[model samples]
Target: MYKKMIKNAAGVILSLSLAIASCGMTVNAQESKDKPSVTSNSLNAGGRVSKNQSGATATTTFSRPGNIRAKAIVYYRLGEDDYHSEDVKTNNAGGTTAFAEKKVSNANVVGAKGEHRVVYGDIIWNDETHIGLTLPNSKLK
Candidate 1:
C-alpha cells in the first residue's frame, strides 16, 4: 500500500510541473509578440500611447551620432476616417549619442489605435530618409 501511494503522488507532481512549464512558455511568447519599437540601420525609435488615447510619447535613439536631425512622429486615427500626426525633433547637437523623446498631445482627438515612425531631414550615412514603423497598438480603455 505504501509503495502504491508513493507512485501515485510522484505522477501527480510530474504532471503539475509540466503544466506550469507550459504556462510559462505561453506567457513569454505573448509578451514577445507585443513589443513596440521601430528601428533603422542607424537609429532606433519607439512610442507609447496614453491610456485614454489623447496623446503619445515618441522617442529616438542613435547608434552613433551621425550628424543628423531626426523626428519621432506619432500617427493615429480617430474612429475610422479621421487621421492625425504629431512630431518632435532631436536636439541636433553634433556627435552625441543620447536618446531624444517628446510628448505629443492631441487633446481634442481621441482614438484607440496608432503607429510610431521616425523621420530624418538630414542625411544618415547608410540609412534611408525614414525608418520603418512600429506595429500598430491599441489603447486600453
Candidate 2:
C-alpha cells in the first residue's frame, strides 16, 4: 500500500509540472505575434485613407517615434525655380496623417527641385491643375 501511494503521488506531480510549463510557453507564443502588429494610425487617420492630388496614392508609414517626426514634409517642384508642397501632421496621439494626396507633410509647401511627372502621366488642366502629387514617394519606394 505504501509503494502504491508513492507511485500515485509521483504521477500527480509529473502531470502538474507539465501543465505549469505549458502555461508559460503559451504566453510567449502570443507575444511573438504582437510586436510586429503594425499600428497604422499614422498611415490612416482614424478611418480616413489618404488621397493623392495627382490622382495616385503615395501613402507610407515609417516606424514613428523612432524614425520620423510627428509632422513631415514632401516637396514637388512646381515650375521653373519653384515648387509645390504639402505637410502631414501627426494627430495629437503621435500618429502622422496623409493628405488626400496620400503624401506626408507638415504645414508647409516643400517641393523637390527635380524632374518628375504627376501621377498617371496625364493631366486635365484647370485652375486646380496641380503640378504633381504633393508628396511623391512612389519613386522613392
Candidate 3:
C-alpha cells in the first residue's frame, strides 16, 4: 500500500508539471473571437486634432476593434502657464475621444537633469479613458 501511494503521488506531480508547462502566459486581450476587436496606441502632441483658441492644444485617439466591449486608459501630462509642470490621468468625457494637453517641452525631475528619466515625463496609461494625477505648469508659459 505504501509503495502504491508513492507511485500515485509521483504520477500526480508529473501530470501537474506537464499541465503547467503547456499553458501560455500572455494576456489574451479577447474573451472570444466574436467579441469587438480591441486596440490601443499612444497619442502625441499633434495627430488627429489641432489646438485652437477654445483651449484645445493636443488630441489623442484610439480604438477597440474587437467585437467584445473594451476599455482604454490614457495617461496625461498636465502643463499650465502659472504652475509647476506635472502629470495627471483623465478619462475621456463628453463626446470627446481625444486627450488634449499643453505639452511639456522643458519639464524635468529633481537632480536628474540631462537624464531621460529626469527630463522626459511620460503620460502613463491609467485605465480605460485616462485617469491620473495632474501635471505642473508650463515653463514656456
Candidate 4:
C-alpha cells in the first residue's frame, strides 16, 4: 500500500508539472502575438497594427525621463485622395519609458473600402523634435 501511494503521488506531481509548463507556453505565445511589428533605432520606437486591423499601438523607450513624448499614428486610406489619420501621444515625465496606443474602430471611410495603410511611431523631444519611423501596411477586411 505504501509503494502504491508513492507512485500515485509521483504521477500527480508529474501531471501538475506538465500542466504548469503548458500554461507558461500559452502565456508566452499570447505575448508574442502583441510583439511590435516594426522597430526603429533612430527614433527608439516600435509600432504594430492590431490583429483585427482595427487600429495600432506605438511605443518609445527612453533611457532617462525628460520633456519627451511618444506618438503613434494609424493611417487608413482607400486611395490617394481618401485617407484618414488617427494619432495618440503619451508623455514621460519621470519614468524610464513612454508609450502611446490608439484604436480606431471606424477606420473605414464612408462608402469606401479603405485599408489600414500603415503605422508610424515616433519620439518627440522637448515638444519640438519628431524622429519618426514607419511600419508595413496592414490590410482591412
| Top lDDT prediction, candidate number | 1
C-alpha lDDT of all candidate models, in order:
0.39, 0.32, 0.29, 0.38
Runs in model 2 deviating more than 4 A are: 1-69, 92-94, 100-141
Candidate 4's error at 21, in angstroms? 8.9
Candidate 1, residue 124: how far the Cα is off, in Å = 1.7
* All candidates: CA RMSD (Å): 8.7, 18.0, 16.4, 10.0
**Could you tell which candidate, 2 or 3, scores higher by lDDT?**
2
lDDT of 4: 0.38
List the lowest-lDDT window of 10 residues for candidate 3: 111-120
Per-residue error for 127 in candidate 4, Å, reads: 17
Would you give me the overall lDDT of model 2? Answer: 0.32
CA error at residue 52 for candidate 3, angstroms: 22
Which candidate tops TM-score? Answer: 1
Tell me model 1's lDDT, rounded to 2 decimals. 0.39
Off by over 4 Å in 4: 1-4, 16-32, 36-54, 61-65, 75-92, 95-141
- Give lDDT for model 3: 0.29
Residue-level lDDT of model 2, residues 1-141, one tens digit each, is 999999999999999999997885655643343221122332332222222224122222333232222222234332333233344443223334344232333222332221111111242111111222345442231
